[model samples]
Target: MANGFEAAMRMMRSRDPQRAEDGFGLLRDRAAEYLPALIEEFENEQADRGLRSWLLELIGLAESAEALPVLAAQLNSQDEMLRDWAVAGLTRLDTREARTALWRARANGTIA
Candidate 1:
């Protein structure tokens, strides 16, 4: 299982579509345990832009409560992609906290 996480990280970072899909499958299944690291990577500004976006998308797909803070933070990002992914993640979460965050963002005109 430990190695699976490493392999998934490597695969998801790959440019190949099939490899990334397989990696995403593995990562998604282990989201509860791996979300923190994934969120950390997503927060790395020095990371590759495409990889950062991909990481954000994966973080949204995980839908873990642990990811709420990061997802909510991204809601106000200047980057449209990040904001969109954050909204999707929050919607996926659908928890009271997530919904509240979304509501606040909407009220603030951060989202439509």
Candidate 2:
């Protein structure tokens, strides 16, 4: 399954929509179990911006409390796309911490 997971990750980075969708389906199904790995990849893998963004999306979609800090930190990202995803993630989470972070970002003018 780990090998399958790795393959799916590679497929997720593919330019082909079908491949990416298949990969996304597999990862999304196992997101909770793979949340830590996804976060690790997002944090440490600096080579592929697209891959990192995908990882962030999956992390956000997981909707776990563990994803709070990762999403919140991205609110300060210079990358507007990442910031947008962060806001979306936090909004989707709707936890106390997530809301607090959103409020702080609003107060700081990090978001609208």
Candidate 3:
């Protein structure tokens, strides 16, 4: 399972956007199993920008409120791009906690 998850992530980092989207799409269906890896990749400075963006979109698709804390921590990332993506992902969550966290991050300028 781990190997498969890693392969999916590698695909998501591929140069082809279609491949990346497909990889992320597969992970979305198994979000509970992939959330940790997704969060890890999102926080990895070495990860591709496109892959990170796609991961954020996947988080939104997963609607896993469990990802909220990790996403919130990203709100404090030094990279503005990461912070922005984190904010965007948070909005996808329908929970009140997600909304509250997003509002706070926005008010504090973590996101535009």
Global lDDT of each model? 0.84, 0.88, 0.75
Between candidates 1 and 2, the TM-score winner? 2
Evaluated with lDDT, which candidate comes out highest?
A: 2
lDDT of 3 at 68: 88
Overall local distance difference test of candidate 2: 0.88
- Arranged by lDDT with the best first, the candidates are 2, 1, 3
- Model 3 — which ten-residue stretch has the worst lDDT? 45-54
- The Cα error of candidate 3 at residue 81, in Å, is 4.8
Ranking by TM-score: 2, 1, 3
| Cα lDDT tens digits for candidate 3, 31-107 | 76677777777667354666666676566556687788877777887877767767777777758998888788779
Clashes (candidate 2): 0
Compute each candidate's TM-score over C-alphas.
0.83, 0.89, 0.72
Q: After superposition, how far is residue 61 of candidate 2 from its true place, in Å?
A: 0.7
Off by over 4 Å in 3: 45-47, 76-81
